[model samples]
Target: MSRRWNPVHPNVTGMLHGGDYNPDQWLDYPHIIDEDFRLMKLASANTFSVNIFGWSAIEPEEGVYRFEWLDSIMDRVAEQGGHIILATPSGARPAWMSEKYPEVLRVEANRVRNLHGVRHNHCFTSPIYRQKTQEMNRKLAERYKEHPALIMWHISNEYGGWCHCDLCQEAFRGWLKNKYDHDLDKLNHAWWTGFWSHRYSSWSQIESPAPHGENQVHGMNLDWQRFVTDQTIDFYQNEIVPLRELTPHIPVTTNFMGNYPHMRPFTGLNYEKFAKHVDVVTWDCYPPWHNDWQSTASLAKDVGFVNDLYRSLKDGQPFLIMECTPSLVNWHEVNKAKRAGMHKLSSIQSIAHGSDSILYFQWRKGRGASEKFHGAVVDHVGHEHTRVFRDVAEVGQVLNQLAPVVGSSMDAKVAIVYDWETDWAIADAQGFGKETKQYAATCQEHYRVFWERGIPVDVITPDKPLDGYKLVIAPMLYMVREGYAAKVESFVHSGGYFVATYATGMVNETDLVNLEGSPGPLKKVLGIWAEEIDTLYPAESRELVMTGGARYEAKDYVELIHLETAEALASFTSDFYKDKPALTVNRLGEGKAFYIASRNETSFQDDLYERLLDELQIGAPFPVQAGKGVSVQVRTDGKTDYVFVMNFTEEQQTVGWPGRSGLANLLTGEHVGEQLELEPYGAVVLSQSRE
Candidate 1:
């Protein structure tokens, strides 16, 4: 089922083309401000996010409010017929507030209080911080609630970090008490504190996981992470009270951060639960494009996978790229500028998945700061003559031309479960090698096949309803939350194709291992039981010989499976467990469930899913044979389908286009032929009217 994309602002139509604008930085220089508006018009940018990280600018001292600077910027935007996404400046507190209210400072896990310096360092449980933020938000809402330029509420700039202060420790205790029904016995059972005689007689003994204190207890660590997420959400809710009261019509959203240092999703907070609090979802996407570690196409699939996950957060609603670098960010180990035409290609690719906007991090580069070298539309020279500016303007033109694609969504028939809780459990597990876990990356490998074949897949959580999906995939699902196994059983029983991988069903939500064999609750439905799992080393490898005489390579991990009602489709051809079942399939009521007992190469997944795709009759949106680096995705209004064909490679490629009659390129207003040639990093948008 395809869900219609909800617009973030009713009055602001078309794709949002602007980004984070810091006009407050230039309040002293009016000439620079004058040039920004001229450049905005030239770039065809319409929306700007303002007041993020502006605590000091808005309030220089305690209660010394300065609304004139903000007022002028809002008025200037309104005068230019642009929208301003006003943000709450609580991400960082002013130095004055930090000095006066030392309680706002966060204490580290080892009990080292942080000095007043960086951002996202405020303690979430501080009542003084919450009160001050609420008061500031109230004033802003009262001033801008009626302003025509105001569009959406940018909650806070990337809400993350944790506070192990005394206040937060007490809050965690209260949270645990409420969760365990105020019973120490239940809490002890859940935490399994009987081991090592760590049973807590009182709540005061329990504290957030600390390196020097209690890091070995998995349950405590898991609960501590959950508590931090809840605490952060609580603080965010406090900041939005005034906005919800004054500007109910405007939607509210906070920019979510993607995974750092690797290709995994952000693990600091569980976005699945936090997504429910926002009216619309938005996130910062800074994939390391053109990196040496991976191919352009391979990295593109990763970006697509994360974008798909973000889109599925709101059930297929179009999300916004709140803060992406237009050129290159200064933070990476090597900050490399985007190649020519890569910006437009990447921007359109975001829209192809489900993004409605292509907003950047900073509109103009900062003069002197940590992010001064970060990419921006206007360089430090402050002109629109640069190559980056031209690329951005080109994207703006394309967005304006593709206005009808706004509020359109993907109709995906497949869903891949990417559970955050499962990821945390797998990472925190004691046995397996941390390098081989790759929970998020493993899911990405499964998704790569679908992405390559142009089959839309919703990267969903385990709890999301599986009613509309024809096929569901769960990779490395080590932790099965309550009732998820039952949900999978019901899905398979109702004629849905279910696929799961190794290291699945090992534990419960609290990192408690299920007793009666592996895949404990799932055994009845899957018709297979795992006796033991062999964790292979980095250089180890094995062969999986299928029953059909096809052989494939397996590595990293393998599970010994005892078939109950299922038949082995493939078996291992090496090691002490030679000829053991490596892959098995079971036929339940109306559907079949397949389990891969070992980690195989991408070739194996490609072969397996190709058969499944044919068996399930799931194909591309249109009958097109896209080249290796070319990708095709579809969005629809039910009466019309917006097809985005993108070339992610550096060479010219020709796609065997789906030459449907009356299908015309939406960007060029020209009809596409049977064979379409795409230049390096090129893209084409076609619209086909179903009516």
Candidate 2:
């Protein structure tokens, strides 16, 4: 018999109805505290994430404790019938700690040791820092073990960034020892240190790799990044393991930065290792302001993909959308407010993709800070009069009315492989590709084709199983880690359709290239030998014509390759490389591997991707209608599926809900027998009660 799939968070079980609540920052304390509870009640919010940035307030001095204020806050929230996801307050260490223990300060890539000012300033490998953080965690856990308000344990806030201190260098050596057993031979082999005379004769000879030194080596600096990630994970485990012993029943987690490029959360810090101590996986998702509708849809799919990855890693336990800005963020140069209905639609999209809870970055607006101007449920005026507040309240009301229809819905048939480690290796490679060859952007382009047609997609990694997906796209797979190529091979050999692009399978786990070919371990399975690579300057492009009479524009990193046992699908039509195969398809065992050798324009990419999907007989969840600014996504629980139709246009635009039969509008409580339409800036959750 298989193991039972436990709910994501057993206590705060149903669709998590909560937002970030920082009452500690308010000076009115008691009066404002009461008002916050009232506002939460009005918004139908039952959960609160507290103590995220309260380290300085809680621990003012060395070994000094001040839980009295927090004690009152927690008790009051519980009295008001709200559940609390208590954070460990390690995100921003107190200024005193940094001043006293300078070792806690982080040294950047340029070897500059930062002074105590910003959050996420401490070095993960600092012994003093780790000890102090662990001490704080123990005290917090011991005090809140049986607290009635406690629902979940939130370990440090958004665990990221790397430190290049001397302590980290020592720690990196130990990490290397454990990984390679202190064998210099294996270490040299893995790093391919021979070409640059970088072979290490002894364990003590190694130093923290930095790109700033006189003899800066990118390969070594990249591995040090991998080292720092492991160190951070170790720090989290130290805190979590002890906390679990005290409160095993309560779930524990740390907020992950979704699709983060640096720190490689997926690889550097082992999710599986941390998942054992964690009950649910949560991430902070902030999409760019300049992104179009397609980008938003792609991001929504990534949120689900990440949740699904965490769920699969944690044995199918649902994950949470820990933090999403309600509206505009502080950083973007021109932060545009999310179009009317887009916020609510995005929330539903999270649920459709496997998020058990929907939470925002902030509940009430900050009076003064870097995020003071950031959008929130309640603005500076502190009332529901603001447009954001009104919109939030409206969403809250809808959530209450259509609770059953919007909660815990899951729908996905195709899964795209997203590996942060592979991304890091490629991005950090000395001479691999251009810095703009972003993994997220590459995968997003492929995902947009499905998202525009309301197709559900799962973003997964190579380690995760590919049992259910009909098509799997792995873009910019630079570093093929251990066993990943085997997994991809197995999936393809079992009659699955796999797609990969340029700069894939170039290196091993340690950034070492496999001399056999560009794809390394995947060469045999992909059936292609890349001989050389060509990088084009901006505005330069090559025309590619498909064998079936489809023409497209291609640019960026183009790989010149020879088909060993594959058929050419498309050929280049420019320069000396004219008529050369630009796209090839190989018959691997019982499956198929499609290889794209150049980055193509979005229109061309969509056409090629759609053609492949058409050939595979994989139908979209809905039909595509001709219209700009209209986006759709499908979410299902294997039976009752929902098609989220949203329009991001200023002018009124009509959108047809394709293949939607016998559907009911979850938002307005109206039933539809066949097709449904949406208006400008209007959104509707069309549910098919019967599959």
- How many steric overlaps does candidate 1 have? 0
The models' CA-based lDDT, in order, is 0.89, 0.72
Show model 2 residue runs off by greater than 4 Å: 1-7, 110-112, 211-216, 259-277, 290-317, 405-409, 432-436, 622-628, 657-661
What lDDT is obtained when candidate 1 is compared to the true structure? Answer: 0.89
lDDT of 2 by residue, 464-571 (tens): 778877788888888787787788888888988888888888877877777887888888778897877788878778888999988988877777888888889998
Per-model TM values vs. the true structure = 0.98, 0.90
Cα-based lDDT at residue 631, candidate 1: 83
Off by over 4 Å in 1: 213-215, 658-662
Quote the lDDT for 24 in model 1.
75
Tens digits of lDDT, candidate 1, 416-517: 999988877777786887678888999999999998888898999976999889999998888877888889889999999999888888887777889977
For residue 153, model 1's alpha carbon misses the true position, in angstroms, by 0.2
